[model samples]
Target: MSTVVDYTTFAVGCLLALAGLISLLAGWAPTWLRHVERPRLFGAWALCLGTFCVTQLPALRTEVIKLGDPAIDACVVLLLISAAALLLGLRRPRRQ
Candidate 1:
């Protein structure tokens, strides 16, 4: 059951990241810009989703129980930090 969940999570994460990349390119690139603006928002969400998948990956690859748990935990922490950064990035800077 856990393995199934993990695989699902990984797949969802990958899709989200890919979607974000496509959206970024679609929105920001002049040649292929999207009709909708605000690609960065999609990029940020994809980053967060990708990080969630990263947290799940250690157990799938590593046999060592000790190593996998730490890696997973670290990724979780990283995901939080990155999400915070994304939120900050989205905020408009105040002019003096």
Candidate 2:
């Protein structure tokens, strides 16, 4: 299989990777997120889905081309959910 991910997939992959890194860092080091009880779990999900997107981008494209929607849908929906988790977690106040 070709190593090249097409432009759209590459763009999504890059975004996912950035989101994952930010989520993981925020969950681990940022003082504000420390108060969020489960930031790390969101981080894990984001990182995992992001890594999956990046690594499997080629196959993902293939799945799309083949009209196998579930694989592609899962990647996008799961990542969005995880990203939302990180965002919501960031909005919480630290424990007193």
Clash count, one per candidate = 1, 0
lDDT of each: 0.61, 0.62
Candidate 1, lDDT over the whole model: 0.61
Superposition error at 89 for model 2 (Å):
2.1
Which pairs of residues have clashing backbones in candidate 2?
Answer: none
RMSD each, Å: 6.0, 6.4
Query: Could you say which candidate leads in lDDT?
Result: 2
* TM-score of model 1 (CA atoms): 0.51
Cα deviation of 44 in candidate 1 (Å)? 2.2
Expressed as tens digits, the lDDT of each residue in 11-87 for candidate 2 is: 67667667667867875534554445565655665565665566466655576657767766766776677667666
* Residue 1 shift from truth in candidate 2, angstroms: 18
C-alpha root-mean-square deviation, candidate 2: 6.4
